[model samples]
Target: MRNIFTKLCVAATIGAAALVAAPAAHAVGVTAADTHPEQATFTTAPAGEVSIQAAGDGTPAGAIQWYKNHLGSTGWQGLCEKAAENSYGVTGVWASANAHWNGASPKHTTGTPPAGSFVYWNISAYGHVGIADGSGGFYATSVGGAIGHGSSVSYFNNYRGWTPAAVPHQ
Candidate 1:
């Protein structure tokens, strides 16, 4: 009986030690703001206009990659438009007017946008656009003074809303 009791105590001590040493479990579906505090300090502009670059190949993943690749690029006045056009094929559309793209039939909403959705803001006459990260975060131009990511839509002034990608993903 004493031997059995000793074994159980040892097992309990080991279990307690393991629990103390275990890393904290991260919350599922946590927003960027929750994980990245620096993203909360995003900067905004009325237009964030730089210069137009090449349009993307009309894929949400590609658009996201394009934004990630150009993280520190400046002079991209059309970065927002370019990102949306790459994924949605809505060329020649302003950031604010992308919702009306012909035949796209976008469903605009003022709530949290899904990943790969096109987010918009009423920043300037042209407005602003960005790609959603699905978890209440977005990747866009003029964040922290260049192409970058932000934690929340509130980081930008006058958030207009969001519209899903032109093509539905399964």
Candidate 2:
């Protein structure tokens, strides 16, 4: 009986140690913000004025990749990494989520969009990319060489029958 009791105690001790030694959730690539944080918020802009870089601009294949490469001088790889799965096609809810998720802040703005936030450009045929400022606006660079802060242009305006969907990444 004593030997059995000892074995049980040893097992309990090992279990406790393993729990303590384990790293945080983020260490395993699961973010606490995704679950603990409240529902995310997005800004409303007149769809016509927003200007995000489009996928047709001879850049990357996805909007998330574009944001990853051109969010800022430092670039937004970490945020891009976090938002990697959020990248869908050129115009979808995932793309919208990319624009809305401006880091942890409620407002990623052009002058100060979150490091990982997406910058959208408004254009025809395709859109553009920029750093998403949590605010209603973003800082975008256009293919025609127009670079500045502006609101996220809806994908609906890009084509004849493409109604833009709110991105799920948010």
Candidate 3:
């Protein structure tokens, strides 16, 4: 196990080095035309985890489900407004997802992001965020256009890690 771990570590280091050496920019997935609101489709096999809830009333999972259903149909601004967003896209998504949290307090989670875990990428001043579909990809706005495959995004750099803004109200 130790030898295997060491090999994996070495491979990861080499991969990182290659990325640093690459020229130009590296996008996560193929984008349509560099526009606002995208609907990304994942190439990776879906992660077998049903994290998002169908009747979410304000939680990370609910928000993800909402995005998954409304992305291409509603668009980013529309979805943000629907999620009761009063801020930027990323912030609005997080707000909407966790708005109905009935827990002690909303907190961000770290480490390996599980399904329903809100994910983010430090792209710009506001950054971009979404919920993991348990799959490698996520359901988020500003991808191809609508909330969809996160890995299928064009700018997959500047990973700011992930967090949980809220859990389901129970």
Which candidate achieves the best TM-score against the true structure? 1
Error of 3 at 140 (Å): 0.7
lDDT of 1 at 1: 100
RMSD for each of the candidates: 17.5, 17.5, 17.5
**How does model 3 fare in lDDT?**
0.45
| Candidate 1 TM-score, C-alpha based | 0.56
Candidate 3 residue lDDT tens string, 1-170: 99999999999999987842312322233244333233346332246533333425455555565555444432353232233221112232333332322221334434555666656554443445556666555666545544446543233455555555454223
Per-model C-alpha lDDT, please?
0.57, 0.33, 0.45
- Off-target runs (Cα >4 Å) in candidate 1 are 1-57, 87-104, 167-170
Q: Rank the candidates by lDDT, best first.
A: 1, 3, 2
- Please give each candidate's TM-score: 0.56, 0.22, 0.46
TM-score of 3: 0.46
lDDT of candidate 1 over 77-161, digit per residue (tens):
3445654554443445543333433233465656788877777766554566778878898877666555677888777766767
**Considering TM-score, which of the candidate structures 2 and 3 is the better prediction for this target?**
3
Candidate 3 deviant stretches above 4 angstroms: 1-39, 42-55, 77-111, 152-155, 165-170
